[model samples]
Target chain A: MNKTEYLKSLSNELGHMPYGDVKDIIQSIEEHFDEGLGEGRSEEEIAASLGDPKELAAEFKDGVKFNQIMKKRKRLKDYAGPDGRGRIFVILFNAFVGIECWLLLLAAIIAAFCFLAADLAFIGLIVAGLITGTLTEFMVPFIFLILTLACVAVFLVALLILGIKYYAKGLKSYIRWNKNIWNYGLGED
Target chain B: MNSQIKKGILDLCVLALLEKGDSYGYDLAGSLARKVEVADGTVYPILRKLASEGVVSTYLQESQNGPPRKYYHLTDAGRRKLDSERDEWIKFCGEVNEILERGETGGKADE
Candidate 1:
């Protein structure tokens, strides 16, 4: 393909793009051809080395799309800058409503811990009875009680670990949400 | 090399080249095509992308022979990007090489 044919194919492929962009792309490629021709290279040589026009056009489209996305992201970031009114509102809301919710969560976690401690204490008493031969007369029943308590303790420990993990995670995300509201005024991400 | 992989590295390559000196589309493409296995046309889109990202800026300058030539220059952001990307590429290559070397030694030991 000659320079004219190559450019025509590229222009045709870039029909979806704005006219200004298509013209600019063509002009740049045209300059490239002129430079190659100046260096005593044939049109076919330059065109062949430029690869496929359709592929080139596709790359151009991708470049345009990438640019648009970058621009949109920059605008969104600019919009997300700190706002004083939002900050005040977030502070007031957090102080009144959010604190209560946090306190309730803290209370629930503490209650669960207390329940687990009580269970452990009961298990301890059973072991003590077994060691001191106080429950030897009812060995089968004591064994059954120990086994059941052990399972319950294991289950509580697992549950407490999981609950604490989720509690920490929830606290972190809630704090992040407060900060986001302070900064971006409840704007959708 | 995979085309997707090549496409990504090409951005770094263009930045590296522009760091050395300002160049026009043809000259830049020619320099890259000489060393890398890519079509000369591929550099233009990369240049356009870099320009859009504010890493590189273009200006038109008069040529001695014919019409004015469009030149691509590296911005400060482009330099910083190049430094970070070069570091990442080196670190990644080091990791891949270590893995490959370990695999080779392991295969030898099995044999």
Candidate 2:
């Protein structure tokens, strides 16, 4: 299957998961395809390497669902102890989490892509600067231009790295957030 | 072996690799699968679990060929887990190896 089809089937299989989780997982998988291309791999090769999405989904469901059951049992005990306010806490918490999940994913997505775009732009500038230097036979000016482009390229690359790091950190927070929703979003004591 | 057991081993292997340095998902998977039999996508789920547990964290690094890669790094918690698990595994395997090798001599003793 192609990237879109693979992601669609995976998400469908993961239909029971928390909404934010499904988005983050699918986004990371999409990023995987992009990375695979970087490694000189075709979509089929990457998909094949990824093995079965259904199995992947099953593992995810197993880990998170297992935790959910345990937390659910704990929450049940707390609610059973004559605490009416606990019910409202559970409802309000899940409602707030449900609404904010996708927005978190969107912010990370935009940050990652912005840095990526900037990185590419600098690479393009370097190439253009080099070509211009070659055609004019201005060796000294060309050297200066290329060196300046290289310095900017390095700086952009660093920024791209930092952006990606922040994006990943944010994604992990979302994963933890999603896991909490499954495992303790029910107002666990 | 059961898949759960295999997955546990895979988890340890991933941790050990990350303990050495950070690695992107596909690269880490490729390294582990080379050393052990595994499905291609298995590492991603393991990664998600680790991330949730605060045992591992991730970042993006651009590769020469494709889009940026999300690299996994071991946290302090992951390192501790790996150390304890590795010790347990070694002891467990040493005992099992001793038991299995005795089969060679046990047959002779019975005769």
Candidate 3:
């Protein structure tokens, strides 16, 4: 089919995704054609080998979302930046950040509650000591204080872990997205 | 030769070709199909994506036979993009070749 007609048909078959995504999917498929053609494949043969355009469009839509396509495009420079290693690191880092942020918030809240509880326990112990004169009151409060302090330390550590995790995971995801079709839902990379 | 592989590489191939010069969609598609097998309809989405990305630009031109035809031209960004991707493609293919050679011939012969 002609280019416009082909796209229109593909759109129809693919359930007509957003115009932007539809366009990106088309571009991605075209690039594949160019590569095969450059290697000396015939047009009719290539077209036939590629199977139905509608089916192909569905495959393309599977892995690659419009957002990821944009991310992939934006990341082209970064992929080429410095060493290839860093790009992977960057993607991993992004994912890590997302994970870390969620965990850190959880840790922080947990720490705060522990801290308050520990302080309350400590006050309660002092009161008990004044009223009853036993070392038991002091011990419970002290233990609570220690536990609260430990939670505080854990919270800080979590922040660091989050930072490192995002870098690694973000990079991994980006690289995987770029090379693998199944990862993005485009098909098999 | 696999439909999956062809579907994956078509867009990159078109963008790479357009980096050389402007051309109508059919001409580009036909040229590409000559090299890699694909449906005529396969090239359109790729063109649309490239155009939308600002990597390539399209303008309507009067056709001798009938309605206006959209001709695609590579932008500077597109050219740079193609250049960078071209580099990556070479490196990736080279690695693939190395793997195949190592696996089948132990570097003693070409496959």
Candidate 4:
């Protein structure tokens, strides 16, 4: 394709993006052609080397999306900086991030383990109570109580794992996005 | 070279050029095209990204040829980034070279 056709196609494909970004990409392409012509190269030569404009536009969109994610992610950086505000945002962010979230999960796990162990001990005590003649009347009901507590602990641990599994998936996406940015900036190094 | 690899280093290559002196889009892109297998239009996006990230800043200068052109200069952050990346790149290449050299001699030794 010639220079004009190539750029028009790219601009059309990227029309959904913000205007300035499209303009910048278009201007950059124009400048590329301009320089190529100045250096005694054909527009076809440059265009061929640039590959399909559709592909180029896709890359441009990916780049813009990546940059937007990076900017949105920088809200955390801003909150870390002096003069942070937006208490609601901070609250929402705090629910999902930092040492506190992990600690909360850990607390739930520990609480579940303690309950499970306690239920087992209660079961042992109830068996002992039934085997001997001490507190024989309370044995059956206490056995049921231990069974209920064991079920609750198992349920609690399962819920925590499911919740953490979702959280881990979200964290993985963020890490992947971060890796894209890193590869863009420092991957060659 | 792989285009993916090319995309990763486009910013570093631009920074390497700007570290020498300020350069307009066309000039830098031309030099890069001559040296690297990168697309001519890729440099501007990187320059825009660097400017937004506060790594590099730009100013318009009147060109002798015709119109005013945007010339990019490295910021302090850009300088620090270039330094660290350059150091890491050297070390990375050195390690790769070591393994390559080992393969070259070690294969013979195994025989």
DockQ, every prediction: 0.61, 0.37, 0.09, 0.22
lDDT of each: 0.91, 0.76, 0.64, 0.75
User: Candidate 4, residues A130-154: lDDT per residue as tens digits?
Assistant: 7886977776787777678678767
Candidate ranking under lDDT, highest first, comes to 1, 2, 4, 3
Clashes of each: 0, 2, 48, 0
The recovered share of true contacts, given per candidate in order, is 0.89, 0.54, 0.09, 0.26
DockQ of 3: 0.09
lDDT of 3 at A50: 57
Q: Over 4 Å off in model 2, which ranges?
A: A69-189, B60-68
Query: Candidate 2, TM-score vs. the true structure?
Result: 0.61
Which candidate number has the best DockQ? 1
lDDT, candidate 4, B20-61, per-residue tens = 999988788778878987666667667777887888998888
lDDT of 2 by residue, A16-135 (tens): 687999998898888778777766899988888788899989988877876668656766665444444544654566579744765666676576567657756765765676677644
TM-score of 3: 0.44
Interface RMSD to the true structure, each candidate: 0.5, 1.4, 7.8, 2.3
Interface RMSD of 2: 1.4
Question: Candidate 4: which pairs clash?
Answer: none
B1-111 in candidate 2: lDDT tens per residue? 687678767778888989888888767777877877787678788888888777899887776765667788899999999999999999998998888889878888999
**Which candidate number would show the highest TM-score if scored against the true structure?**
1
